[model samples]
Target chain A: MSAEVELQNVSIAFGNFYAAKNVNVKIGAGEFFSFLGPSGCGKTTLLRAVSGFLEPSQGKVLIDGQDMSGIGPNKRPTSLIFQNLALFPLMSVADNIAFSLEVRGHDKVQRRKRADELLDLVALNGQGDKKVHELSGGQKQRVAIARALAVEPKVLLLDEPLSALDLKLRQKMRTELRAIQQRVGITFIYITHDQGEALTMSDRVGVMNDGELEQVGSCYDVYEAPCTPFVATFVGENNAFYGKVEKVEGVKVKVQTGGSSFIGQAGLGLDKKNYKFKAGDEVIMFVRPEAISLKGNSKKTQNSFSAEVKTIEFEGNLKNIFLRSAEDVDIRFSVPSSSDTSGMEPSKNVSLSFSQDNAVVLPTGALALD
Target chain B: MNSFYKKNGPVIATFFLVAIIFWLVFLIVIPQLYMLDLSFRPNLPPLLRGGPDDVYTLTHYKHFLYGSETSKDAYNYVDIGVFLDTIITAVLVTIINLCFCYPIAFYIAKLATPNTARLLVLALVIPFWINELLRSFAIRILFAGEGVINNILLELGLISTAVNFIALDIALYTGLTYAYILLMIFPLYNALETLDTNQLEAAKDLGSSTVRTHWRIVIPHAKAGIASGSTMVFMLTAGALATPVVLSSPNTYWFTQLIYQWFNMNDNWSRGSAYSIILLVVSVTFVLLMMRLFKVTIGEVVR
Candidate 1:
């Protein structure tokens, strides 16, 4: 019921502009893989390529080791859930779910039976007789899932299908989607720009930027050890320090920026390049906001700086403290709501520090902000 | 009504209301009521009007079923046959126009680029700027013997003799179809333009072929437009006089030609009015039947 999907040097170009550039990844059978990137970053284009709506201009797409060139969407063994769901408004829920079966010449009884089965699978039992518009937003989402699964496709490709839902429904659907994927044991290729969705639901995440897959790794690995400045800033919130490397020692590099020095681990460059640190290479040091602390001293932390607290934003579970360094560089760090905040006030002087292992130093190329 | 008066002041609202009333009463209702009245009276001589012979009767309506009692069969087969022929031909023309215009409308609305769509619309509309009479005459000349098409075919050695297109009613059908093509196309285009293109891709991705996709999705969604276009084309074609006269051969006849002859040649306005009233009733019934068949409301079609 599941198949391995592999892209080998695939590039899709519209005239002179490449929508997807030389993307290569092998999604194993039954794997829940996700492509995470911002808008216009080629994630949707890559998903379209896999679904056979788009043909790669350069290389091959293989499903179960079968070359998929010249195969149209109708002949492919994959189902695509569009961003807007694209359910047939003229049809009942049963008919919408059974559309694939109907098109394949199945009789009405078989289609209805299979449609009901799929509805039950999606936890929408007995909703088959209702019109598509009669269902709630979340129910419609489930109907789309049921319709896609009715075909029993080897691969299910979703192009930000949950993006239109409200926050709570989206969260609930994410878990349900993960559970359904495991139950069916089919390959699921999900495309989205939300880092939370990718981090929580996907077994492996591919971070894309400017038509290029910048990083492909597990959620934990991508968050903990990003190889490029784009991935570091794009995958999560990070305080980036523009600096020059002062020295290299073992796996750690010391960088000096804004009259302040920090030591962090060296990171690799883009996919194949082995970026080495030296005494004069310009770099960017990234540290997650949660990794920084206000109380740690120089003896306990490797990098220490004094800054003036600008503002303290109290989110329900945590408080985000905005600060301005002595050199006027803006910094932000988060503290748990349970932590003591007696000394933390607006415009008050505070000392902040983070351990070296929590920060990463990489050669700057393209920042996600740019 | 009150809101309209408030929005546009009393003077403007009253003026608009008066103008609409005048137009409806004088232009539409009055003329139709006069014709209905005349249809029930005998076509007596002018001197006999308001005399003993001037009386309301069903004689004019009965004349349609039995034109002249002097014949042996007395069933008025020619008139009835011509009426049925006109109806069947109009239906054929409607079906042909639908088959031709559906793809063109879909292409313009969905497949063509915006620039190409604008150009195509311009091309379709530009020919309609000319009078329909002239367009019908042009089609008549094109399909006539030794016409442009036959001349080309002769030059290419494709035909040994000239084809009698008018005798076959091909010229008439072509003229009628061309005359009302825009009426069919615009409505279909308006409906198809609102269709989300993702639905097409979704159907294809679900393994539906192009034919099945249209049968199951596109056609069902465009039912209102189809009903509207079909009704307009059928009514116009059935009631048409100029196209049939210009494009018909010696062997062809149209029901409107009979009505025209009764009014002008026989000086029998009563019979003409009766025939026209019947045509209107039948056309309205056909429209209602179509609406019922398509499962659409009048509001949907009008919209």
Candidate 2:
């Protein structure tokens, strides 16, 4: 029902300034791909370029192998749901959904029938005669989706459609949006600055910074094995410890910090010679909060450190214990509230350990190493 | 109560009341009441204060609506031609200005680049800084028979004889309406600019072409502006005096030219006051009818 999209080394420029740099991405058919980044990071620009509002300054934007150059937005087999939803306030719900059909010169009866079908598709059956403004926010959101789907566009583009809703409603819409996308079986290209929205719904996400794509991967790779410091800080909360590479043996590298030595796995494609990490070569260790486990009355892993608990953050199901080592290397360890858990008391010394596989040694320059 | 009065409260309220009373007597109520009285009296006798005998007569209105039999010429008689001309000219001017101004307004509102839009708006405003009469005179000079236009035409071999450009009714209408083109554009620009561009994009993304988008999203949203601009252009062109006097030949006259003829040429203030009242009623009626037809509030149209 939907066609795939491909952007091959595409770049967009405004006079001398590049709004989107050489970006290459392939969205396969029926994939819920998301372009995720903060505002002004060129994700929306890239989406607009794909939608034919903006023409790429370099390379090609192809829809299923057909070049989209010189094509206007209306000519494209793509539909975009604006951030404001952009529903026609003057029309009834049915007319708003059947707008594209009317443009295509379909008769009144046929357009109405198609509108009714789309209303049912979005679960607003029998409500097609209601005025657009009469609908609630959620209903308007569904109408926008139904209107976009009425044209049966090969690719549906959604630009921060849920950014205007409250947190709880946004979450509810998230599942509903994903479900609707799945039911329609269209290639949905969603754009959002919210990392949670991307991770929860996307088949894959392309993280953008400035005007360039920083990394493209599945949610797991983007969150865990982030190739750049920007991605590590952006994808989720991460605690970083500065260190020096003391040794590299096989797949593991031992990095020495201020008051102790910690071991972590070296990244895959980083050139070792480029880093030239001899003994005492500066490096940075990136660790996730959940990866650090408290070793209470249990045998520790290959890497363990003694740290005094500085603060306890009670997050309902899980408690995040903030620990400080002798060198004052503050670290966080997430412990779930279980029956066997030894309740962590603040200011108590505890041993927290994580396997080298869980920690990654990122060569210096991308991040500051103390 | 005396203490409160001494605390500047009574003084402030008294001053405000006095100001309102003064405005009512001098600015609004007095002139209108005077005009109403004048509309019922004979021209010469009322000007001479012929006492109670001159008060309360339907003679001026009847004479303006149905001409006097003793008059040798109908043009000399107070006839309904002026009223009809004023309405027809105002309607035509409104239509003409709307056609010329809407596209420019849309470009400034929706499609123009930032700097270019600003420059275009600035260009529109530039001609207004000079006196409007001077501008009209400048147009006259360029088109006059012995002026620059005829000379250029002669040089270019386009015409062998000088053309009398100002000896036409169209010149007066064109000049007067063009003077108020900017006024029509401002309200339209404001309305069109407030429309959501994303709505247009959504329409386009839904397979509507540029024309369809303009009709559905752009025009409907610009209703308030259109209504407002129509009111302004009608009121202005209907009540205009200077353009016709300067540009029109004596054979063909605008309605305001006739009203002035009553007040100044014939010194018939009673007939002029009746014409003024008729003009006011017609303008108000047309505006009300338009508002009702368009389903827009007067406040929305004005603001």
Clashing pairs in 2: none
Expressed as tens digits, the lDDT of each residue in B1-303 for candidate 2 is: 466457769878678778879998899999998998888887665445786566677877777766775776645333466577778878998999999999999998889999999999999999889887887887777767788878999999999998887785656677877889998999999999988889888888888888999898888989999999999999988888887677776776677887898899989898889888888888899889989987999788868
Per-candidate TM equals: 0.96, 0.91
- Going through the candidates in order, their DockQ values are 0.87, 0.78
Weakest lDDT window of 10 consecutive positions for candidate 2 chain B: B73-82
> Considering only chain A, what is the TM-score of each predicted structure?
0.97, 0.90
> Candidate 2, DockQ to 2 decimals?
0.78
lDDT of 2 by residue, A1-370 (tens): 8999999999899989898999988999999999988788898999999899999999899998999999999999999998999999988999999999999999999999999999898889999999998988889999999999988899999999998898898999999999999998999999998999999999999888888887788888888787766677678766677888889887678998877888887753322222235577777777888787766434446677888878877788987778788778878777686634455567777777777787877666353122
User: Which clashing pairs does model 1 show?
Assistant: none
Output the number of the DockQ-best candidate.
1
lDDT of 1 at A299: 56
As a TM-score, model 2 comes out at 0.91
